[model samples]
Target: MMPSLERASHWLALVCRLVAGIALLALLTVTIADVGTRYLHRITDGAIALRVSGSVELVSYLMLFSLLAAMAANVEKSQVVVEAFSHGLSSNLKNRLHGVYLLGFAALGLILFIGLLDSAAAAARHGEVTQDLRLPMGPIYYLAAALSLLLGLRSLIHALLSAVFGADGEVSHGE
Candidate 1:
């Protein structure tokens, strides 16, 4: 890889980590504020009407993004793997296994992409809305689907790099 490309990847990964952390913090803040407002309103017999509607939708979005960020880290560390067969495999066989893993990830990514489309369509048809805030659920599902797709793409890339470069800085899943 060129120096610039490697640097870009590293920067992108760092940004993803930062975004995931911020999102989690936002979720925590929202939850705490909602709870405090609700409690205060009840105690004072005030009409605060603090509702946490659509927050769950936001949670789902943030959760999936956080998951994808974690998955990206796993890919960077080469820490995601199918261990059931890997543990018994010889070094020579591990190379072949990695190739198979790549192919599997490609297929899985395609399948997940299709499923996400279907889910989005279904959500549109049903007009599913979040209970409290009436936020559409489509976006959350799409976010999760996108994360799954990215994970699959990262797996495929990892396999390609491993196959071509032969595990220079690769971190083993076992570690």
Candidate 2:
């Protein structure tokens, strides 16, 4: 990779990780606050009432976004393999096959990107919103679509590196 491209990739990876971390933090923060406030309400006999309405909806969205944001960064690290079947395969053959597997994932990510784009458009057209939070679904789907596109791009790059340059080191899913 060129120096500039490598730097850009690092920046993108950092941003994605930050987004994923923030989403997960939001999920945990909301969960903890809800639980604590619920306990307070119980202890005070309804005097200290603090119900987190729409918490489930918010948490689900946060979780989904976190996964989407992290997808690109995690793609290279989370390799799944059936070692029993491939134990006898040569290194070159294994790398080529792994490249193909990554390509499949890339295709899947792109397909998801396209589907999410349609979902975003449909949500915008219908004025759709979350059931409990009432948050607009279009923007949410749009952001997810962007993340899925990044996932596809990242997977494609990994596939190329693996097949052409043998740049990938085998990372076991077991770890």
Candidate 3:
């Protein structure tokens, strides 16, 4: 990877991770608030009827975004290697194999991004909205599609970098 592209990927990864963290935090906060409201409502004998309306919808959306937002960052690492089988292999080979795996992810992400863009357009045309909150679904689908595009780009970049430079510090070491 070139220095500029590497830096861009690093910054993008940071941004994606931050987005994922924030989404997860929001999900947790909403879930806690919903549960707390239920408990309070039960304990107060109908005195406190306050509830986070459409919490399930909120949680499901948040969870989807949180996971999706991290895909860009997670594509670089998080490989599962059953070392018992192939620990003896060369690191370059491992990196190349990992690159191949990431290539597959890149393709998958691109496919999903394209599909999501189509879905977003369809939702906008149909005037779709969340069942409980009645919030427009077009924006949500568009954001998901954008994130998937980012994931695809990141995966493609990482795949190329890993394949060409080897992922085990070989780039820096000139190996």
By lDDT, the best candidate is 3
| RMSD, every candidate, angstroms | 5.1, 3.9, 2.8
lDDT per model, in order? 0.63, 0.80, 0.83
lDDT of 3 at 47: 100
Better of 2 and 3 by TM-score: 3
Across 60-155, the per-residue lDDT of candidate 1 in tens digits comes to 666767866566545545434678857887765576456556656656766876798689778878998766667787876686576566656665
Estimated TM-score per prediction?
0.64, 0.88, 0.91
Q: What is candidate 3's local distance difference test score?
A: 0.83
How do the residues 1-175 of candidate 3 rate in per-residue lDDT, one tens digit apiece?
Answer: 3665676677778778898999999999999999999999999998999999999999998888889888876777756677986599898888877777788888988998999999999999999999999999999999888888889888877788777767641222222
Give the Cα-based TM-score of candidate 2 against the true structure. 0.88
Runs in model 1 with CA error above 4 Å?
1-15, 39-51, 54-57, 78-110, 168-175
> 161 in model 3: Cα distance from truth in Å?
0.8
Q: Please report how far candidate 3 places residue 12 from its true position, in Å.
A: 1.0
Worst 10 contiguous positions by lDDT, candidate 1? 166-175
Tell me how far the alpha carbon of residue 5 in candidate 1 is from the true structure, in angstroms, after superposition.
Answer: 7.5
Tens digits of per-residue lDDT for model 2 on 25-126?
999998998899999999999999998998888898899889988987677766677899789988777776777788987898899999999999999999
